[model samples]
Target: MDSNNLDRELVGVLFPGIVKNEDKAITCLGGIRNISQVYSNPSKRRLGLSFQPENPFVRKIYGNSKKGAGVLLKVKVKKVKEGNEIKREVVSTTVVGCVKTMFRFESMCDFQYLAVHREGPSDGPVSCCLEKILPSGVEVIDFMLQPSPLLLIPSSFTRFEKPIGYAYTDKRHPDRSSPEPGDSVHSKTRMLRSSQVSPYTFNLTNELPSEPHEVYVKQKEIKFDLHPRLIEEYDVVKKLFDERPIWSLNLIRYHTKIRLVSLKVIMPCLALYMKTGPWRSTWVKYGYDPRKDPAARKYQTLDFRLRHAAGVRSMIMSREDITTDRERKPKRSAAEAAAVSDEIAEGSVYFRRGMTPTQRHIFYQYCDIQLPEVEEILAPEPPPGYLCHQKRGWLPANTGEICRDHMFRYIKDTLFNSNNTDLKFEGSGNGSSSNSDDGGSDGSDGGGGMSDEGGFGSDGGGGASD
Candidate 1:
């Protein structure tokens, strides 16, 4: 048969070990009943087995060879309880396994191993051994069995009007529409069409409106009643201004979070005082500027007012004078030079004064000068155009023991002296003596009353005159 076209069912049998009397057979059958109940449980619904006895007593069944023939026993299985009680019936089939040819009179009997199948057409065999002998001499045995194998049968189950058993035509209904192969009755047709009547038809266009569409709505205007106190307060405030005042009562109510009457009365009085004080100018500058159009100036005035009020309140409540308590300690005198010398002797080479010329120069450049030396070094030099009448090469001596401050002052003085001498020479000398005709102006007053020979005089003479 074709493997694709097969129908199979699952069946089973139970073999009781041995029975010496009729009552023993009944007891042996009771064991099968217990196994059936176990199989009927929902969890064990798939479990199924079948056993067939080959002999009534001890009979040997032939195998491939007579020497290796196995024993077979006549086994009968009766349905104690159907397995479908708890679940759907499972499709399964069963077959036989090995058996012992000899009847052993031992405390326990053993049977051969059995094989189980998962998807084949046959259920493999199971083996059993007598474990306990009942009081009636019946053998109570337990066997290990495999789950039954089921061959799923395929049938031509379809929703066709007629079976495909044979191909034929009905002569009585010759005009009937024959369905094409694989045509389904639920099929539908779809159509697509263009809105234009003809393929070459052109669309007509319309001109758009020149003006934008405007929508007008009639909204009901609501009027609220002003409290008597609020009205009086508004009147008082309005009296301050010649024109009718436009006060926002909502703003007053929002700021105070109080009744309109209370806010209106209190706000105006507060505004009156605020407008008279130093805050008056600030208020006008920030909030009450009538020069500005209302719509153009949004919440600028209100924001300024809020900030100003907050600042004023903060300033009034804040402490302007604050005093702090700090501990004072006596000033300590500078350590003696001898102590410093001793420390230097014990410190690193860098700290000690035993440095090379280069090291000493670097150290001196890095050190701070004393106040007296700093003053001398930074003192302003004599003005340019001043004569230095001292000996030309009279160089100042450098004292080896000179402090850093004094050394700096000496360098500054030397630079200043050199600069003054250069200025004096340049001021006294003219470029040439050929221009004697233009001497009166250029050589005398032109030179600012200073002579070419490094002297000050009204005339162009090399002499000093007061």
Candidate 2:
């Protein structure tokens, strides 16, 4: 290797397909590339004029020195007969793409190169004296690379799709072990085949490995106490409303440790639930009016379409697995949900994927199997000013709705009754507080609820009402 040659660009030709005599390989490339028997690639599909004595492309390539360009040609083979000898002849040639022999100087290790013709005697044949082989850089082609559109590659994040497994709700022998008496009868034989190491030895009554001690891992003792009378719960719930205006059923059950059956009886006496607007699907304090209070901004709802940032894993469930998950849950009451107890509890372990610096060093010292990392996948944080707790614009409320007559035959004006707003005026903050001892729909005050004071993003007093 010459030191001066290291700084120089190597001349190379970027060919797409192998130069092979096989007809099938030529058909795959659509007759654009030449054949190996004719071009004679010495090694690694390399192109050098030094190899063959009868290659016809050498003259065509070297003849275009001043052009300073490499070319991809479409050539077809046809039989040519001269007397008794018949030879394969290239009858067609079309220029597909021309490669420019130019290079960008900055941060570019890749470039195209064209071989130049060496100066020689006028009567002598031209030759190129250079390295044995120069590696080529690849560039995309204009033609369709794939003829079929059925094949595709999915994202790596989608490792566990519907193809993995369906929902399995079997309660007994979750590991599929033979725990039944029928399974034991099936294993019966005239000769004793049971070994000490056999999995059949595993049973519910199997003794512990260490000393016999009390085991309580699977089932926790959840004792449901007798529910207090609804009249007595009214005062406790009113105090709860004073603490927080909005609460979900799960939070209601989790905080007070009350069963769902009692919650149903007590909830109607105090808080109200809405099907729409900011407090949709959750309990809202009955008498709190959004009109005069700054606290209304805390529960205000905003509508914005969410999409994962580019190149990030999607938070949306893959549709393929939705069917299995949907079948697991049927519509159930709040009490039934409380019994299932899917609420998040305190002191759960949330871990990162990669090992700590000390752990990494310790694990790198050996090549034994170890437990896999346990990183949790958390959702990306919302943009600033997007959360419900954030300060809102001069917008009256998150949303407000009109209460009109339910008659379909004629149009009617909205009904406004603000009298109930004074009923639970001592709820939380200002003259208005959240939580329900006596339930009322939104803006139950004298004039109209928050809906009369405009909503979301509009001038106050009947702005943005729907």
For each candidate, C-alpha RMSD in Å?
Answer: 45.2, 28.2
Model 2 residue 203 distance off true place after TM-score fit, in angstroms: 62
TM-score for each predicted model, relative to the true structure: 0.11, 0.24
Among all candidates shown, the one with the greatest TM-score: 2
lDDT of 2 at 151: 21
- Relative to the unseen true structure, what is the Cα RMSD of model 2? 28.2
Q: How many clashes would you count in candidate 2? A: 9
| Candidate 2 lDDT trough over 10 residues, lowest sum | 359-368
Q: Candidate 2 on 1-466: residue-level lDDT in tens?
A: 1133233333333333355555443343223354333233322232222123222222211111112355545678899899999999877765555544422111111122223243556667545422212223452452235232222223223332223446778643334444457565645533224211122121223331321112211111111124336445556776887887655554565566665555655664455553333433445666653323444433432221111222111322332344432133457997776666544332111112221111100101000111121000001222335323212222333221111101100110101112122232111212111111111232222113343333332322232122
What is the Cα-based TM-score of model 1? 0.11
- Candidate 2 local distance difference test against the native: 0.32
Give the distance in Å from residue 26's predicted Cα in candidate 2 to where it truly belongs: 45
Residue pairs clashing, model 2: 19-36, 270-436, 285-435, 418-445, 418-446, 428-433, 443-449, 452-462, 454-463
Instruction: Residues 396-459, candidate 1: write the lDDT tens digits.
Output: 1111112222332333334335534442222212222112222111111121222223332212
